[model samples]
Target: MKTKKVVVGALAAMLSLSVCSLAPAVAAGETVQISVGKVNAKAGETFSVDVSLADIPSTGIQCLDFAVTYDSKVLTIDKVEAGALVKNGADSKDASASLAPLFEGSVNSSEGWVSAAWSTSTDDASYWLKSDGVFCTITGKVASGVADGTVSDLKIVPINRETYSKSGVTNKEISCGYEKDGKPVKYATTLNNGSVTVGTIVTTTTQPPTNKIVRGDANCDGGVDMSDVVLIMQSLANPNKYGLDGSDSKHITAQGQANGDVDSDVKGITSNDALKIQKWLLKSISEL
Candidate 1:
C-alpha cells in the first residue's frame, strides 16, 4: 500500500510537470514585424517602396522604431525618410501604413520608422536603389502584427570585377526595398537591370584599358608605381604639345571616369615606372 501510494504521488508530479512543459510560453515585451514594400529601380530615377506596421504594446504603448540596411559597394545612401502614404493610385496619404512625411530619416530612425536616400549604380546599365522612409504617426498599433518595409544597399557595378580584391568578382546592388521586424511581405518590384556608361576616349594608338592600362594604380599590384610614370608619359608627352585640351583627358579617379591626359606629379617619366608597368603587363617595352 505504502509503495503504491509513493508511486502514485510520483506519477502525479510527473503529469503536472508534463502539462507545464506543454504550455506555450508567452513572448517578452516588444515584438517587431518587417516586410518588403517593393524592390526595384531604374538607373538615374527615383522610386518608392512601402512598409507598414501596427505598433501595439502590452504595457503602456510608447513608440516603435525601424530601419533598413544597404550595401556600400552598389549604393550611396543620400538620406532616410518617412512620409504619409496614400491609398493605391492616389496622390496622398490616407489610411494604409504611411502617415506623415519624414523627409529626414536614417537607417537608425528613432521611435517608429525612417527612410534613407542612397546614390545607386548600374551594374549593366540596369539598376536603381530606393527605400521607404520613417514618418510621424498618431497612434502605436503594433503587437498584433507588424507590417513595414526596409531600405537596403543597392549597387550598379561591373558584371565581374573585384570591388576590393583582384579575384573577387564585382557586382552592384542597384536598388532594393525590404522590411525588418514584423510579419514579412513583398511589394511587387524587381531591380537588377539598367546601367550607366561613363566612357572615355583613349588614344586610338594606345590599347584600350585592360588589366594592363590602369591609372593612379600603375603598379597593377594596385598601387602607384614607376610603371605608371611610363604610362602617364606615353599618354601625355608634353601636356602642352600633346594638344591636351586637358578636357580631352578625364580629371577622373574612377576607372571608367577617365577621359583625359593623365598627369602624374612624378614629373617626367622615370625608369622605375617602366618596371612596375612591366610587372603587370607580363612583358617589358624592350621585350615587346
Candidate 2:
C-alpha cells in the first residue's frame, strides 16, 4: 500500500509538470525591414532611392551596419544622408544621460557600394531606435553612355553577422540589437532589395500640338487624351500588366508618372489623379 501511494504521488507530479510544459512561452517581437522606393532615372540625371524600415522593436537598435551595392558601369554613387527618422531622433528619447547616436555612411563609386552604420553610446533600456520611417537616402546619377532600358540591382552587402546575407554566401560577423534587463537581445528582420532602371523614351502615335509636354500626359506622348486616360486607368487597375514596377525598364517613365498629377498635389499618383485627368479632358475644369 505504501509503495502504491508513492507511485500515485509521483504520477500526479508528472502530470502537473506535463500540463505546465504545454503552456506557450511569450517572446519579444522584433523586426527590421528594408524597403526601397521608386527607382528610376534618366541618363545623366541624378536620382535617389528611399530606404525605410518598419516594425522596429523597442529593444531598439544598439548598432547597425549594412551596405548597398550598385552597378558602377551604369550608375555612380553620389552621397548618403541621414533620413528624417534619424534626424528627428525617432529612435532615441531626449532624456538626460541617454546615449547620443552616431551615424556614418559613404558612397564609394569605385567599389560601387554605399555602406552605413549607426549606433548609440548607451545601450540602456532608456534608448530605443525609431520604430518606423525613412532610414536614409541613397542618391546617385545615371552614368552617361548607359543604354536606355538598362536595369541594375541594388543589393544589400553582407557587412556583418546580423546583416542579412545571401544564401551560401559568407561574410564578416557583426552583432546589433537592443538591451533588455542588462542583457543583449538579437533582432530578426526582413530585407527587401531594389533595382534601378534607365528608362527608354516612349513614342506614341498622338503628339501634342506644342513641342512641350503637358501636365496629365501620363504616356509621355506629348499629349493628354483618352489614350492617356486609359493608360493611367490600366496602370492603376493592374500595375503588373504595364510593368509599372520600377525594376522593369519598360515601366512608366518618371516624368510621365509625375505628370499624372492632374490634381496638382504632390501626394502621389492615385485613382483620384486619374479621375481628375478625365475631368480635365472633359472640360469640367480649366486646370488640373
Candidate 3:
C-alpha cells in the first residue's frame, strides 16, 4: 500500500492531460473486460463489491484508474482496498514475475462515488498485473431507511476531471494498459455493472413463516428434485418469464426463492442454489 498523498500525486501527474486519441485500437480476437460484483443485503447492513479484470493482454497492465458511482440515497461508500490481483501479483504467462503494486482511492459518500488508481510501484515491467482477478474492493453501508426490494446499481464510469480534480485528470475515459517504451498504451475495454438488492430481513417480531418453507422445493410441487433445479436456473436466466413475478404460469414464487436459497455462501436464489439441488439428487451431498 502506498500513502494516499503519494498515490494521488502520481495519478495527478500521469493524468494531467488527455491521452484518449493517442491510444490504438484493440487487437483483433483480444478481449478485455472489467466487471463489478453483486450481492444482497438488508437496509443498514454493510456490504462490499469486487472490481475485477479479465483477459489481460500478453504484455500485461501497469496502471488503472476508474470510478464507481452508486445511489447515495441508498448507500454510502466506506472504504476501498487493494485486491488479490494487486497483492498476489502473479503473471499468467510468466511463472517468475512477482509484482509489487500500489493502490489508493478517494471516496465521496455524499456524492455516492469513489475513484481509485492502481499500478506497479516501479518502472519494471515484471511488476505489472498480468492475470485476471479482483483489482480492488469497495465497502459500503446501505441506508437504514431503505425499503426491502430496493436495488442500488454499482456502476463503473470514467474518472471525471471535475470530480477527481484533486487526483488530477488524464482524460474522462477509464485509463488502463501498460507503458510501451515509456509511453502509455491504452486497451480497448468493455464494462459490466453490478448491483446490491435489499433483501427481506427476518426479525423476531414479524417474519415470513419458516415452517411453510420446503427447502429445495423451488417449483412448489411438494418435492425436492431436478425440476426444482430447472426452475431456479430458469428464474435466474430468464427472470421476466420465470421470476417471482413472471407472467409465465410456471414462474418460481416467493416461496420458491426461499426454498431455493439452500446455499449459505451466497444470498438469494442464484445458480449455486441450483447446483446444490443437483448435488443432493446425485447423493454427492446428503442434504441441501
Candidate 4:
C-alpha cells in the first residue's frame, strides 16, 4: 500500500508540471476598445465608420477572430479594409515584418448583422505590432428610406474557445497572444461597442391652395357644365382673342386653365379637352 501511494503522488506532481509548462502566460490589465465614428448623411448618401482599437500594447498581438454586427435597416455595409495599426508596425524595423492580414465574413443587409473572422499567418502573427489606432474601416451607406432620428447600434463580438481551433490539428489553438518572455502570450481583453444616429431627411412637397379647385371647371363657375365647354372651345379657337374665358366678363384664372385640363396628362389644352368635359357632363364618360 505504501509503494502504490508513493507512485500515485509522483504521477500527480508530474501531471501538474506538464500543465504549467503547456499553459500560456497571461498579461494583466490589457484592454482593446472598439469605437465607431458618428456621421450625418442625406438620404441615398454613403458614409464610413471607423472601427478602431485604443490602448493596444506596443509589443503586439498574434492572432484575432472578431465580428461586428449592425442594424441593417438603418445602414448597409459597403466594404471593409485593414487599418494601419494591424497592417504595419510601431517602428520602421517592424514595418517589414511578416504581416499578412486576412478576413472572412458575410455582410447580411437583410438580417442586420455581419459575421467575420480576421487572422494572420502563424509566422506573421509572431511579428505583428500592436498600436493604438484603427484596426479596420467599415464603409456603409445609410438606407435611403430609413426615417429620421433612427439609431443603429454596432456591436463587437469575439468567438468562444471551445470551437476556436481544430484542437486535434496539431498546435492549432485560437489565440490573440502578446509577446512575453521570448514567447507568445495570451490574456483576456475588454471590448466596447459603438452606435450612430440618423439625422433629419429633407423632402420637397407641393401643397394645395387654401381652397381647392375643381377639375374641368374652365369658366371657374364652380362646376363642369356646358359653359365650361363653351369657354374651352372659345379658348382653343382663338387663344389670343378669346383667352380661356370666351368674350364673357369673367376671365379664366390660371387655376381655371389647369382645372380645364380634365385629361390631366399635362399635354396642354385643346378642342379634345373641351370635348372630354362635354362627354363627362353628358354622362357619356364616367370622368375626365
Candidate 5:
C-alpha cells in the first residue's frame, strides 16, 4: 500500500509540473477571446454547447485551463470532449506521436461547475493549437422539471485557485499558455459567456396562405428542419454561393429570405433565424 501511494503521488506531481511549467509571460496588447455558444432545448432533452477560441495568437497555445459554471437546477453536465481545433492540432503532428494531450476534466454536479485542462506533454510548438475554432464541447441534459422559457447562464471562471496556488504559480487566471524565449507565457484573455434556453412546445392548427410567408421555411420546402438551418448559415457565410442573388441555382430566393426572417428585430435573415428554426425542430419552441 505504501508503494502504491508513492507511485500515485509521483504521478500527481508530474501532472502538476507539466501544467505549471508553461509560465504566464506578459503579453503585448494582443488578447484572445473564449466564447460559449448559445443553445435551446426542451426539458429532458440533451444539448451541446461549444467553447470556442477566437483571436488566437500567432505563436499559438501549448496549454489551456479553465472552469465553467452553469445552473445545476436546470441542467446536468454529462461530459466534455476535445473539439475540432484540438483534434486538428494533434493531426498536424507526427503520425507516430500520441494523439492525446495531457487532459483532465471533472464536474461538480452539486456545485454546477466543470473544470478542464489540456497541455502538450512537451514544449513542442508543433503540438500547440493554432487555429480559432472550438476548443471543447460540453454535452448536458436539461432537467426534466425545468420550466419552459427558463434560461441558464454559462460563464467562464478561474480554476480552483486555492488548489493551484499551492504550486507557487503567481497566475491562476483562465487563459491559454505558450512558451516565449524559453519561458512560459500567457495571453490577455476575454470571456464571452453564453446561455441555454428551455422553450415550451405549442401545437397549432392554423396555417398561412400559400402566398404568405412561412417563418423558418428558408428553402420553401413546406417545413423546417436541419436543412433550413444549414441553408441560412451557408447563405450568410458565403453569400456568393448561397445568397439570394448568387449565381448558384439553389441560392436563397426572396421568398426564402422573408420566411427565414424569424427574428423580426434583427432586420434581416441572420444566424438567429437559423437558431430559432433549430429550436423549433427540437420542439423546444412552438414556432420559429
Candidate 6:
C-alpha cells in the first residue's frame, strides 16, 4: 500500500509540472506590448501590428484588460472606416474623422472593434503624438464578447512609425490574436484575415430625393410591361450604347461572390424580368 501511494503522488506531481510548462508565462501588471511582425517598412507606408497582453497578471488571468501603446511621433492616425450605420436611437452617429483629444483627453471605445464591451478613455481608439512616450494603444478587453458572432473584423491598425501621416494618405494593416484556456489558440493576418489599406476612401451614397427617376421603368410602357419585354431583348442583344459589350458586364452579389455568368444574374438586375415580359407578351398576342 505504501509503495502504491508513493507512485501515485509522483505521477500527480509530474502531471502538474507538465501542465505548468505548457502554459505561457503571463506577467503581473498593466502594459501595452506590440510587434511589427518580422519585416521592414518604409516611412509613410503601411505596416502590420501583432497585439498581445503585456504587464500581465500571474493570477492566471481568466481575462485580461489591456490597451496598446506606441510612439506617435513616428506615426499618425489617418481615417475611420465602417461597414454599417447605427440607427438614430443607437449609441452614436457615424463620424468619419479620427479622435481629437484635449490637453489631457483620451479616446478608446471598446464597442468600435471586436465583439467587446471595451471602453477607451477617450471617445474612439485613435491617436497622434504631440510628443510621445506612448501615443497609439489598441486597447483590448479579454472577455468572450467576441465568441457569439457579435463583432466582425475586430482588428487594430498600426501604420509604420516612419511612414504615417494625417493629411496625406497612408494605410495600416492590423492583425488580431486570441488566447484559449489561458494559452495561445488562434489569431488573424492579411491572408484569410482581412486587411484595409488606408489609401483614399471614398463613400458614394446617392440619397433618395423627393422624386426618384429611372428611364426604363421596368413596369410601365417603358416600365415593367410588355414593351419592357422588347426593351429587354434589345438590351440583351444590342447591350452597348455607342459600341460596347454592355451585356457582358454585370455586378451581382449573392451573400457574396457574384455567380453571374453569360446566362445568370451578373448584377442581380436580372434579365429574368425580361423573360417574364416575354411570356406575358406571348400570352397577350395569343389572346388577341
Better lDDT candidate (4, 6): 4
Question: What are the per-residue Cα lDDT tens digits for candidate 5 across 1-288?
Answer: 011122212222332333555434566886777777656678888777667776777777766777889999999999988765677554345342353335555678888888766665445676777766667778888899888989999998866543232454433456466655555566777887777788742222223224698888888899878988878765654454566665677777777777887975344555567778888899998866
What's the lDDT for all of these models?
Answer: 0.27, 0.56, 0.68, 0.52, 0.66, 0.25
lDDT of 1 at 187: 25
By summed lDDT, the worst window of 10 consecutive residues in model 6 runs over 81-90
Q: What is the TM-score of candidate 4? A: 0.48
Off by over 4 Å in 2: 1-29, 90-101, 123-127, 160-175, 200-288
Better lDDT candidate (1, 5): 5
Worst 10 residues of 1 by lDDT: 137-146
RMSD to the native, candidate 1? 26.4
Q: Model 3 clash pairs?
A: 15-169, 15-170
lDDT of 3 by residue, 71-184 (tens): 999998889887766775423433223432266677877777888777654556766777766678777888898999898998988765532335433345665765556555
Scored by Cα lDDT, where does model 1 land? 0.27
- Model 2 agreement with the true structure over 1-288: per-residue lDDT tens digits: 011122212222222212223421222465566655445567888776666666666545655556778889999878877765556453454332243335556677776878765555454544445556566777788888787889888887544221122223233322345444533454555666777778743433232234454688887877788777766544533343332553334445556666775653323344456678888889998887
Best-first order by lDDT: 3, 5, 2, 4, 1, 6
Residue 223 displacement in candidate 5 (angstroms): 18
Candidate 4 per-residue lDDT over residues 1-288, each given as its tens digit: 011122212222222212235655666777444444433454566665555555556556654545567877678887767654555632333322233224334466665665433433335443464555556666677788776777787777542222212222222222355434455465455555655557642222232222565888876777778998876654533333344333445544456666786754323444456768988889999977
Q: What is the lDDT of residue 109 in candidate 6?
A: 33
Best by lDDT: 3
- The TM-score, computed over Cα atoms with residue i paired to residue i, of candidate 5 is 0.60
How much is 255 displaced in model 4, in angstroms?
Answer: 50
Where model 5 places Cα greater than 4 Å from the true spot, the runs are 1-24, 89-100, 162-171, 200-288
Please say which candidate is ahead in lDDT: 2 or 5: 5
lDDT by residue (tens digit), candidate 6, 1-288: 011122212222222212234633323232223221111123344433222222222222121112223233332323221111111111232121123111111233322322111111222222211111111222222222222222223233431221112213221322122233435321222221222222222222232111333323432222334554443433322223100123333311111111111112211222443444455456743310
Q: Where does model 6 exceed 4 Å of error?
A: 1-78, 85-174, 191-288
